[model samples]
Target: MQDNKIKQEIEDVELIIGKIMQIGVLIAGAVLIVGVVALLVQGDGGYAAGAHPSRPLAILAGVAAFKPYAIMMLGIFLLILTPVLRVVVSIYAFIKENDKLYAWITTVVLVILVIAMLIGYFGK
Candidate 1:
């Protein structure tokens, strides 16, 4: 009985994570589509020649200014973030289930991901 309950709870967590990924992809795709459509309608890339915002704050500023490239960048950012979000949720679910081993493993994975992202961002 306890095993069955644990299995069921794990299944529920999986379902929730699936939904989160699905929604994240859909929203990211929609934003990308909007950016593409705007680019097509404007008949230009909407950025200075050979230049686009690469930093988060710059991207946000460009997005606030309605730059199509920034919108597309945001979409890409969200797409990349989906799996990170899944890892975070997995960590929480594991902790909830009292699975310290898996929770610690997932936490390590998250730390690695963050480190990689930071290196990628600042390495440029």
Candidate 2:
């Protein structure tokens, strides 16, 4: 009947959403791994430290010369954003169905990413 068809469609949609979530988790994991590898491959941040410009006012121009610094900052931002997005998604998922494990795992990954980013950012 019409009710059965609607139920089947809902189930299909849920299945697709679940697959997308799994893919998202994998992507986040991959980004974390790549960030670690980058840290290891490039010591000293893999870019020139802020160099003094010829002009006295050039100190503020460090952003232009510090390519690695910019990249590092971008990675750090991504690390932070990932967790924030995960939290939002996790809350919605929790509302639909009370599951804490996914939220916890996302949080743990976020923490680790933040720590690694800090170490890399400061260690540079």
Candidate 3:
């Protein structure tokens, strides 16, 4: 009985995680579409040849300025962020289930992901 209950709860958590991924992807796709439409209407990407916003602040500023490339980049960033969000949700779900081993494992994975992102951002 206890095992069945735990399994059910885990299933619920998985469903929530699936929904998160689905929504994230959908939103990112929509943003990308909007950016594409804007680019087409404007007849330009609004950036110099070979120039693009690489930093978060620059991206945000460009997005605020309604730059199509920045909007598309934001969409790409959100797409990349979706799986990382899933890992975070998994960590919370594991901790909630009192599953110490899985919780610690997920935490380590999250840490590694953050480290990798930092390295990539800085190495650029």
Which tens-of-lDDT digit does each residue in 73-124 have in candidate 1?
9889989999999999999899878999999999999999999999989999
lDDT of 2 at 100: 70
The alpha-carbon deviation from the true structure for residue 106 of candidate 2, after best TM-score superposition, in angstroms, is 21
Candidate 3 stretches greater than 4 Å from native: 1-5
Candidate 3 lDDT trough over 10 residues, lowest sum: 49-58
Candidate 2 lDDT over residue span 7-79, tens digit each:
6765665665566566666665665565456656665544456642222223224334543434444444444
Off by over 4 Å in 2: 44-124
True-structure Cα RMSD, model 1: 1.5
Ranking by lDDT: 3, 1, 2
lDDT of 3 by residue, 8-108 (tens): 98899999999999999999999999889989998877799778888888889989999999999999999999999999999989987999999999999
- Residue runs of model 1 more than 4 Å from their true location after superposition: 1-5
Better of 1 and 3 by lDDT: 3
Question: RMSD to the native, candidate 2?
Answer: 9.7
RMSD of each: 1.5, 9.7, 1.6
